[model samples]
Target: MTTIRVQQHAFDPGAEINSFCARNPTSGGVATFIGQMRDFRGPTRAEGETVAAMTLEYYPGMAERQLDDLVKQARERWPLDDVLIVHRHGPLVPGDAIVLVAAATAHRSEAFAACEFLMDWLKTQAPFWKKEATSDGATWVEAQASDDARAAKWKK
Candidate 1:
């Protein structure tokens, strides 16, 4: 089964990973990625210090649709046993896992590749917006051209 969830509360990666792998008899390998909040103080800010919090927002229905599309694409390309994606919204602090992607496959190579592919697609194409709160103030992080290029590699 494939599951995608968007929530305000935290999650247990170990539990999620275990649940994804438990019933899949055909899956021999499972790969997972967890993205965390980074304490980014922009170059212009005085005294480069840790960020206090990060606020994430997304268009509810649109974000879920986009993520489902990404997961569907992964399923079309890979012989995956299972996949799970979880992304959190609202305020978060450093070291908090922002998102999680897991892929289960018969082989490690496929599992790893699919996991990476999902993350790259999410980073570039997902409609989530992020703002960092620092001592100075809060600022939104712009999407990078590099991220677009990274996502382009997966296209046929």
Candidate 2:
């Protein structure tokens, strides 16, 4: 089973994983990744400015299609038993959950790899724009070169 959901509300990653693992009887291992809102900006947290919240925007139909395509590619490349993806949009405060991903497989390697693959793809490929709200001002976030490089590692 491949489950993908784009929602505006928050989600619990632990519950999501438990539900998936409980339903998928054949999975011997499960891996998960959660993306969260960070409170700092600049070179590093210690030196960066404090951020209050972030607002994310996306075209609903297009975003879902993009996510489905990534899931399809993951399924093609791995012997995954199941995968779960849940992403939240709209305004979010620091420490809030932004996305959740879980990949289940017969072994730890597959589970871990697939879980990372989903997150890496989502970071670079997902169609969403984020605006960070700080006490001073708000700014749109650009994808970092580090994220691009990470995603490119699994390129075809």
Candidate 3:
């Protein structure tokens, strides 16, 4: 089974994981990754400008299609029993959940790898635009070189 959603509404990670476990009882392991909004940004992530809010934008149908395609790619590479992905757009403040990715498989290794692979792909390829607001001004977030490096490792 596969689930993909893109919306402005908030979601509960705990509940999502529990639901996934219940639905895939044959699986021995389930791995999940949750991304949250940060309050600050800097080298060491301790000092710097504080983000008041972040706005995410994406084309509705196209965004979901891209996410669904990534899930398909993950399934082709791993023996996954189930997969789930949820992403949010619009204004998000500090501590708000941004995205959730989960994978279930008969073994821990497959679950873990699929979950990580999906995240790495999403970070680099997901067609979403993000703008962060700070005391000074709001700026569009650009893709990081580190993200590209991480995603590249999955290539066969």
Candidate 4:
């Protein structure tokens, strides 16, 4: 099973992982990653800028198509039994669950790698535009070089 969802509502990552594991009974391992909103951005809280809130915007039709394509790519590269990706949009506050990625496979290595690959692609390639509301004002989030470097590894 391959599941992809993009919505504004929050989701329970733990529950989603448990559900994926239950559905893939034959799979020996299930790897999952949950990305949550933080109060600040940058490497450290001391140096990072504070963010009061965040809003994500996207072209729904295009976002769904891109997510579907990402899943296909992951499946082609790994022997996955099931995959799930849930991403949130719209207004969000600190500590909100932003994304969930789960992958089940017969071995831990494949499951781990698939989950990592999915997250890496999502962070850099996903079609979501983010705006951060700071004390000063709101600013559109820009792509970071670190994210680009992480995604580039998959190309090789």
Worst 10 residues of 4 by lDDT: 12-21
Q: For candidate 1, give the lDDT of residue 19.
A: 77
* Positional deviation of residue 31's Cα in model 3 after best superposition, in angstroms: 0.2
TM-score of each: 0.91, 0.96, 0.96, 0.96
lDDT of each: 0.88, 0.90, 0.91, 0.90
List of clashing residue pairs for candidate 3: none
Clashing pairs in 1: none
Instruction: Give a tens-digit lDDT track for model 1, residues 42-89.
Output: 454365666889999988988889989998999899899888999999
Q: Candidate 4 at residue 108, lDDT?
A: 96
lDDT digits (tens) for residues 44-140 of candidate 2: 9999999999999998998899999999999998898888899999989999989999888999998898889888888888899999998889999
Q: Report how far off residue 125 is in candidate 3 (Å).
A: 0.9
List model 4 lDDT by residue over 26-94, tens digit each.
999999888999999878999999999999998889888888898899999999999999999999999
Q: For model 2, how many clashes? A: 0
Prediction 1 TM-score vs. true: 0.91
> Which regions of candidate 2 fall more than 4 Å away from where they truly are?
none
RMSD of 3: 1.0
The local distance difference test score of model 4 is: 0.90
- Give per-residue lDDT, candidate 3, residue 66: 89
Taking the tens digit of each residue's C-alpha lDDT, what string does model 3 give over 39-71? 876655567778889999888898899899999
